[model samples]
Target: MISKDKPAALILIDIQKGFDNIEYWGGERNNPNAEENASAILKLWRENEFPIFHIQHCSSNPNSLLNENNEGNEFKEEVKPLAGEIVIKKNVNSAFIGTDLKQQLDAAKIETLVILGLTTDHCVSTTTRMAGNYGYETFLVSDATATFNKKGVDGQDFSAQLIHETALASLNGEFATVITTDFLKQNLL
Candidate 1:
């Protein structure tokens, strides 16, 4: 449980339409209710007037679904940033790599970060790892992130659920504390 006395920020990473393209991201995904969970957290953060940072991934690859010119580059309605909220755009997996996200968090005096978003094994994991390395207390909402199937180096196929679980497990104790959205709401509120 997080203490309400500490300042925290919600960092939503790459919750965009591009992730809806299952063909591009591989086959089926895990956590069908991920967007709903993200929405719930976003709503709670907004209602409490907590800082929220929306990370947008703009792929530099022209063939990528997340290309800046593509409609898929747009944010999903569920987690779109409202006016006055911060929106950081990046072409890399880690939001802090080429963006001012860290500086902004520092300036805002954010002691803790609640992170959730698309593709549990990708941007979400990368950002969480970086956040932990940068010395911020990070919480990853398990149900609020999803990932699609992937092919291993030996051509073995991996299920989306397996990938998601593995990613979360890798980050659980090292990068962030893995918690459910329900748990977060119950503890924070």
Candidate 2:
């Protein structure tokens, strides 16, 4: 359980619309379900008045799926940021890289971060590890992040469910404290 007195921030990573389109990941991206989880987290955070931050991925090349004006590059409707919420754009996996996230955290006196979003293995995991390196106590909501599996060297394609489970095991309490939405809600409130 986390102490409510400690300053905490909700870090939302790459919950962009691009994942919704099957063509982007060759039908491997877990879309609709991932967005739903993100929405729940966002709603809870907003209701509790916790600090919330959003990260947007921007690709330098216009040909990239995350390029500016691409439909997939925008935040999904289910968990769009409200007025006055901080939204930071980055080209890298970690939200803090080349963004005002660090400064915002510093200004808000945030000591801990609770992260949830799309693509668990890539953006979520990388950002969680970097959050630890940045000296912030990090908690990863395991059920809220998803990653699609890829073709293996053994000629087997992995399932997104398997990837998500593996990431939960790998990230629990090392880079971040792994918790579920129910557990977090019980502890937070």
Candidate 3:
């Protein structure tokens, strides 16, 4: 439902090296190509001169994988932004919680956001829900997002991939619309 009449922004979040580990997903999500997928979306946004925002997570503990000093905290090379792109750092799951994301969006007159990034069920989901609550039309690039597997509350081996799919399904036509890279590439003006 995103059209050229409504200004759209691309939000890329936390496609970091920490997501590349096998243990994070109980070995079920070994080869996630989120970076490549995100990169293609980024290219389209850049070519069209649409607003693009990059988000990075900062962990509170020095020992954490997303610690500011860790190379894993940096965005993967494939989706890394070019010079002059807006980059926002956050300490929570929602990028706008303590960041200037909302103000930036307002300044740019962006009413819609096309989101793609790492950990689909975490930061991506959090931001999508928040954006919806804040009245922004949001779309999630399903295949361009991923997540790591951790223990569920029931203590079972949760599948990160499955959880990601569930999150995508849950958001469709509610919090956000879930679309594919091909759909975006074809529909972007």
Candidate 4:
């Protein structure tokens, strides 16, 4: 549950259409309901008038699907930002790096961050680490974030489910509280 004493922000990181290109990211993606679950959370944040931020990745790699010029860089329909909501553009994995995310959060006096978006092991994980290090109470929604299968260092193929779980396991204690969408629905409502 979120603390009522401090202001919290819901950050949607790279929920861009580009991520739908499963094979490009790795292979099969886990958590097919990620976008739907994230959309539900976003609706809650909006109805309550809580602070919200949308992070967009303008990949530095021109060939990348998320490149600025690519339509794939556009936010997905389900959780697309409404007019006047804050949208931060980033060229890297971490939303806090080379962006005014920290500054915006600081300005808004935000103390807690609820992050859910894109591949759990990449951008989501990186931003969660920074959020925790920067002293923000961060919560990462397990079912609202997902990843694709990845090639192991030893040349083995890893399942998307395995990669997703491992990423959450690694970040659970040190970076953020790994939770499910059900947790939010039960407490926030």
Candidate 5:
């Protein structure tokens, strides 16, 4: 059960269409069900009338898939931001950087955060770390976030699932409680 003592906010980070360009994003991404899972959680949050923030990555790289001018910059159809919901635009990994996210969350008196998004090793991880350091009790939905594969310095190839799992492992306990989408929906709904 959620505590009424402290408010909670749902942050859907950078789940943009640009990420669909698999080859452009290092290819073979993990967690194919991330968007659907996120949408389920989003529905639950909306039904509960909890605070929700949709983070859009406005990439500075003009050629990037998520560049402001590109269609990929748009949020996915499944989890699009509804009217009156908070939408924060960020160009960097951390949503709090150069954005009024912290101020908005503070103004809403939010003390607990439920974060889920694309690219688990990057923006999602960075934002979760900051949220924890900022003293927010954060829960990261493991099945609702994912990442693409990366080539090592020695030219070794790593799978996206490996990266996703490692990223979650690093954040769990230290920064946020890493749980599945089912776990979150079961508890919250």
Candidate 6:
């Protein structure tokens, strides 16, 4: 368990409608209740008056489901940012790159981060790695993030669960302390 004494910020990354397009995203995904889990964490953060940051991914590729002009680019209803909450928009995977997310967190004197969102192997993983490298005590909510199937370099297919677990395994201990939303609620809430 992490120390609860330090100030913590909730970082929500790319929880958008684009992820709903399973076909566009390549195949079936893991964690059907990911949005609900994320919403639960968001509500806890809001209720406790913790700092919150919403990261929106605006893909540069026109064919991408996350393209700015596409309806799928819109944020999911569960994790939508309200007034006074910071929303960081980026075209890349890492939220820290090409964005003021680090500066904002630094300015707020955040010592820890509670992160969750769509595509666990992408934006969430990147941001968690960067956050760890930047010296923040980061906690990744495992069940709150989901990812779809993918093809490996050798044309081997990977299941969504495999990718998700692999990503979390890579991040655990090295990038962030991986925990479930239920654990967070039990301990922090």
Write one digit per residue (lDDT tens) for candidate 3, span 1-189: 555566589999988777666664356662267778899888877876778899999888898788899877888888887899999999999999999999999987889999988778889999999999899988899888887666878898777767887888888898998988888877754
Count of backbone collisions in candidate 2: 1
lDDT of 6 at 43: 88
Off by over 4 Å in 2: 1-4, 29-32
* lDDT by residue for model 5 (35-93), tens: 99999989888887888999999999999899999999999999999999989999999
- Give lDDT for model 4: 0.92
In the order shown, what is each candidate's alpha-carbon RMSD?
1.0, 1.9, 1.8, 1.2, 1.1, 1.5
What does the lDDT come to for candidate 2? 0.81
* Candidate that beats the other on TM-score, 2 or 5, i.e. the better one: 5
Q: Which ten residues in a row have the lowest lDDT in candidate 3?
A: 22-31
Q: What are the runs in model 5 whose C-alpha is more than 4 Å off?
A: 1-5
User: What is the per-residue lDDT of model 6 for residues 1-189, given as tens digits with 9 covering 90 to 100?
Assistant: 333456489999999998998987877899999999999888877877888899999999998888999988999998889999999999999999999999999998887999999889999999999999999999999999999999999999999999999999999999899999988978855
List model 4 lDDT by residue over 1-189, tens digit each.
464556479999999999999988886999999999999999988887889999999998989899999999999999999999999999989999999999999998898899999979999999999999999989999999999998988999999999999999999989899888999878744
**Model 4 stretches with alpha carbons more than 4 Å out:** 1-5
The order by descending lDDT is 5, 1, 4, 6, 3, 2
Native RMSD of candidate 5 (Å): 1.1
- In TM-score terms, candidate 4 sits at 0.96
Runs of candidate 6 with Cα error greater than 4 angstroms are 1-5
Clashing pairs in 4: none
Q: Give the distance in Å from residue 131's predicted Cα in candidate 3 to where it truly belongs.
A: 0.4
> How many clashes show up per model?
0, 1, 1, 0, 0, 0
